[model samples]
Target chain A: MPDTLFKPRMNADIKRRSYYSKFIFNSHFLIFLTIAGGVFLYSLLGLLQTLESSIWLDMIAALLMSMLLLPGYRSLLKPADGIFLLPYETRMDAYFKDAGRYSLMLGISKVITGAVVALLILTVGHDTFVISLFLLLSLLHYIANFHINKRAINTQISRIGMTPVLFIVNILSLMLVLQHPAWLVLSLILLFAMGKYVKRREHRYLDWNAYIEHEEVQLNRYYRNVSMFTNVSHLEKQFKRRKYLDPLLWKPKGASFNKEKMYEFLFYRTFARDHDLPMIILRLIILFGIIMVWMGNIYLSVVIGLFGIYVIVLQMSQIYSAQAYLLWPKVWPVDRTFIQRSYVTYSHKSVFVISLIFGIIFAAIHPALFYIAVVFPVWGYLTNRIFSRTVYKKEQELSD
Target chain B: MVLQIEHLTGGYSKTPVIHDVSLNINKGEIVGLIGLNGAGKSTTIKHILGLLRPHSGEIRVDGITIGENAEDYRRHLAYIPETPVLYEELTLKEHIQMTAMAYGIGEETALERAGDLLKIFRLDTKINMFPTHFSKGMKQKVMLVCAFLARPDLYIIDEPFLGLDPLGIDSLIDLMVEERNGGRSILMSTHILATAEKYCDRFAIIDNGKMVAEGSLDALRDEFNMHGASLDEVYLKITGGGIDNA
Candidate 1:
């Protein structure tokens, strides 16, 4: 019965993968990949041209090998599995075996990709035997690292504890790879024995909560990545208060305000407290500012300024739907139009401030960009007006 | 009547989950909406709260329909959903303050009511704590506090007893009774039939999106031809042994 239960869950995961793949293969994602691929190829070519020694190449290979060793087990276990399937714990060997095999395959593919990249970088004027030995040793390191991660999970080791262990293993693997090949095989066998021992130990307890939590973290990571390109409705939001930014929300103490003013304060606080939105906006502004300063091109600065505003507006618009799930806001005595107006006002103010900062930075960088600075506030106001009438209107309609 | 729903037919989509459901709550009346899951008790309440529009009939609070004036209609009622829906970003104190502001309650009145309700719910100490730090029952208490602080003419509570400790449950009942005696009406949906029987002035039993039986305990007993039947027994019989097909 437990084995049968695995089939539906596996099928659901497959369906999720297929749905995500469809989105990943969409035109926007494909275009992004094409551009990224071009940049990567250009950089790789530049690195190959600057190749100084085999030892430097080996160091890079060691770093890439360590990154590939990071452990991730995608069991797709849900919280309810702990309760609903507790009775069938003894019979869950086949289920776990299948899950382990799936994860192992994924880990192997990643290692293979890393090895291929390493080979491409190391192959120039290098011995075929040395390159083969390097590939073989890296594979062994991957297997050992994967098993160590499994043991860590079974033992409930914190990631902080696992990090030094990973570092030690990576150093050892690099040393062994740089030495005789026989040591690599011996280390691989030792790792395998340790893995078998840990596997046996873990079989004694279900540890359903830990496995479910791991799977949820893994799923959230995938969802978060996918959501950057397109909307993923089922993705759960993770929030942080960002206490260091508390001064940004400074207001006069004991200030009395009406409901509309209170709403404006709430909107500001919501943006400040969100874990990702504020950071994303700040990062974009900084990145664009750096580019403007470096290039000192007024045209590029204006474009970057507009792009910054666009990005800020796009992310800030999420505030409209932020409180949509709560019944209190919807059922409150405040008019719905008031809420809409508050959102619009908040968006306009945020965009205006961001644009003003960008404009000042650009003006400071290149005096010729002073006109761009003056134009940004007006542009921000107009963009926000249009956004509230159009995009915001559509969002309201869709939510309704 | 504080709340009046006349032949309401509404649900998530065009196909109604609740059909022709009609109920009314007079001033100071505590009406229990009793049913198994998916018996449309929540749907009826949703229609009353104006969260869901009725397919055909009209729902009026203080004789004003939601379509006629949404803000006025919402101002007259306070709703506690089956599950707590708190603002993740807001602290407990902020939630109450925001609720008060939204309801147009004066600052002094809001502070007094908030202080009393927080003390009663035993959440005064966690006043500055965020909802993320709260336990399930603590979150429910926060919702209860916010609702009570609103001081609306009608209270729409769904599954209010869930996740509440025995003491918390007793406090909730005490509050409901106090509100009723203050001439505020309540329409509560619950599966805890015994408690509902004790507190409710009338009971409305629904099954399969329609009303199966309704009235006071004596009236329900007389209607079902089971003299002195308890609310739970009456409910089980009406919902066909309460199998919870939903």
Candidate 2:
């Protein structure tokens, strides 16, 4: 064993590992699981059927909860934290191969769960063709997992690449149903074969660097979106500060005396840098805009508000992902007064921003329902302030 | 005394890495902690810094135990970890500011002190740069600046010379001497016995989590019966027997 095997030569590596470990395990994994699990549950619950336009929307949601969420789940759930195990460069192949297999198992599980949910929901209407299609696709996706796992182990194939080519082929198969039957079936089989082939090629080469790079990109992307969701200002500050971002710099007049301003700094920074917020925003814009244009149900607006609540929770969790615990000011002669005050202000500011956006959007949906939106934002802001303040106080007490 | 560790026995958890290790340094003194890997130099430092909970010992910083008032106890000491730990999101300026804020330095004083320290470390141009952009030596410089910002009574530095260029190493030694002259104490760990021998006022040698030997060059030399020999000679005489270099 090298003298430095367990001992990091530098404090930075130890500190970085320490800091990131908290994030990867506690905050990052928790948030990923929460979002993925919540969506899966929501889809399973058949909650969106109230706004039910077509079976296609439900299918899409199920598909999203399966494919996109699984990729995310895979990233967080994989053994990135146990990187020390791969200390021997010679063992990298075997180590990552196991990791790849683990990822594939997770992917297969997600595919199976999704198919079961789809089958249950679709079987109620008794569409034999669609039912058969779902099963066929599920089986193909499951079989494709070994390939996906191999690809991940061998190469830099992204989540973007790991997408079910069979799903697209099935859709194409659907499109070509009337004109060319045999070719459609053949295309679907070929697409599955291609996915399997690419996966094999990836395994054959075992491109460790590429796989690591791919994983890094996925993590960065996730963190970026989460950071954006949590604090838009922080993200902007890190990147290029937009002229529009400057307006938020001014502390709301009366609240200026309060530490909300400090939180605003952290909040804005969190959203701007995290991955969850931007993903949520993109999701909200695409989802809500579509619902408004097509469905236009006032009741669905309530659903949107609830979804916004989920989004807000996700955004808040991203702050936790930054793992402030590892950055304990205990080592420094930090001003207890300032940290105490700033902690409260930070959480409050986050709540206020979330409530404001949800309130304004919900109110804009209908002028008559403006009170619900208004009350919700105000109530949420105050409640979160009180709750988070208590939590911070309690933590401080524990530390003391 | 600047730092005092008495009977410290702690490690990751349950199993102790440092077994009843006791050591101390007075004001204006430079003490070296020398050990092979897994000999628990870092663990000993962690106890002194109060980062670890001693299963059976007491750690005092400038005459106050960490249990008395952790925050206040910390005020007397600054630490340079073996590897630099920086906030990737924060710019170098922000890191300095954060450190300043934590230490309760006024913003103006923090900035002024930060400026001087940055210049001293030859990092004036990189204040606006994020730590993510810093090279290994530059990151180490940032950690050094942060540690020096407080000018505490004691500096508990772990593996200070790693990743430093020869000039950087020289400057660090100069800084250590300068700080000691200013009535601060430094307890540092290193594999570089020659530098440690040249600069340290006293030395403690730990092996297998136990203190094998300690004292000034002459004292160690006398103890090991190697008269007028260097610290290395004494060190080798004490530890070279049946010890795996690997």
Candidate 3:
């Protein structure tokens, strides 16, 4: 067999490409990026002007050391991979070795970037010896950390025990390099020896489950970050039932139930139980609320409030499409039109509630913007109507 | 006929897995679809459930083709997939209620049937628990309950015995028989030859995307010249004989 392990990675890359093509080229993304870039430049210039060289060096060292804690391999091992790929374990050694090299290259770039940032802040005459020594120590720390992590995968050493020890050692090695460069070579030799010892002592059995779990965590983290920008097709969402939010989904006892009513209830419960939709709405509201209060520009705040509502509405609309992947919905006896109507109705209610809160917060911050309380609901209703119509039209095309 | 599949040929993609296969189940009849793994059992089931469009054939439920009236056709059939597919967030009771709502089952009827099925499967006590933490067998039981609760005119069940406990299996057979006696039809696919032989009114044996033989046990015995042979023997002889002949 040809190395089939790359198939999953290839599929993921295809999904990622489609996702970016749909969202990254949009005007909303461009606007968001422009605002973010402006904020980042403002912060960077201020930090360079105010922070001292010593503090910058300390921060860089801490950051570079922390980066070493990340895993040094991307096995891309999914759950099914255990059964499918475990049979070819002996042949997979080369694949894993390549993954380790790739991870090390990524780590090197992160360390170099941090070091360059520190150099820019320390613009005055800097010690060449110290800089070179820091780079060498950082490289050694990365290699040693990678070996330790690989060993921990199949070894008696608990990750809880090994992680702290490795972190302290990495930090101490860097500190020694800065203060006393002569002792740096000795520390590197000792770290390399320890890494070799760990490798030699570790059990040979492959823990495919742990590897798959680790890879999934890494992949999920990447997908979750990308999901903030656009919908990710393969991201498995986490679900949580917030009991305190139950009252929000409650219906009166002995209430009459119909197809539409049941659909409405189901949609409500799905939204409340899902970890992403509700959290995304709350995050946008809080972020906009803080920016509005901090900037205290009534016009700008109102504009942002409107834009925030738009973004939330767009994201919330994803719930309607989400159920399409499920079987029960497609197999349900109810007409597709009724299902669409229920989705539109429930989404409108959710958006209205969210926009009302945004309006209340904006009014509280700037009493002059009290008109937002009225304007927000009207705008939300109109947007919901327009978005729902577009969504339904697209769905109609797909079904046809 | 409650269910009719005419010259159905389809798969995941353009290339067909099950080719030109035809089968039917009449009212109050139970038909067993028996085949080995990757022998197009699931592909056939998928065609019947309207999950996959037939490459070049038609499937009908209650005399209405899936393409002619998708919603109405779906309403007439209840499907139990080989692997249990349940929403992780929904409790056991919620699953049954959702199925009831989807099928438009009356509240009183739903309540009565759900109560009885839950008790029969010994899942009554766990009605409030989410299936997220359910064992494999428990999850299968939940799927069984969902399908049973639908009470549709036709039940398309695929490999219903896997991951089910012995008692759960017995309860399922009993419920399926009860449904059949009540004038509902069932088309079940399984690798469990003995169980299928015991419960099925007739058997349709498929191989390499083709139906090799389909009839009552006596008819199959007569055709294969395996007089008095068990269903298992007949299956092995047919498939093994095909390989040898090929």
For the second chain, the TM-scores of the candidates in order are 0.97, 0.95, 0.96
Quick one: best TM-score, which candidate? 1
Reproduced native contacts, each prediction: 0.59, 0.30, 0.50
Q: In model 3, where do residues sit more than 4 Å from their true spots?
A: A1-22, A43-73, A77-97, A104-206, A241-247, A251-256, A275-277, A299-311, A373-400, B7-20, B55-57, B222-226, B236-246
Chain A TM-score of each candidate structure, as shown: 0.75, 0.58, 0.73
Q: Which stretches of candidate 1 lie over 4 Å from their true place?
A: A1-11, A21-33, A54-58, A83-97, A104-129, A175-201, A241-247, A250-264, A275-319, A337-339, A348-400, B13-15, B106-108, B212-246
lDDT values, one for every candidate: 0.77, 0.63, 0.76
Task: For residues A1-400, write the lDDT of model 3, one tens digit per residue.
Answer: 4265565565675576576767755887677657645664566667667756674465565456555544455666669878977778778876676566655664576566666655554343247777676776776677778867876776666767877777777776776666668878877786877788788877777878878877787678767656665556677877785667766674312335556566676778788888777787788899978876765667666767777787777777666666655777667777777768888779888888988988898889878658756777777888878877877787678654
CA lDDT for candidate 1? 0.77
Off by over 4 Å in 2: A1-170, A178-205, A208-271, A275-307, A314-324, A335-340, A382-400, B6-22, B55-58, B207-214, B240-246
Model 1 clash number: 0
Residues A213-302, model 1: lDDT tens digits: 878888887776565434466767666766566567733134354577567767887888876667777887887687667545576567
Across residues B68-100, which tens digit of lDDT does each residue of candidate 2 receive? 887789888888988888765556876675666
Ranking by DockQ: 1, 3, 2
lDDT of 1 by residue, B25-127 (tens): 8999999998777889888887887778778888999999988998899999898988888777777877877887888776667778989988988888887
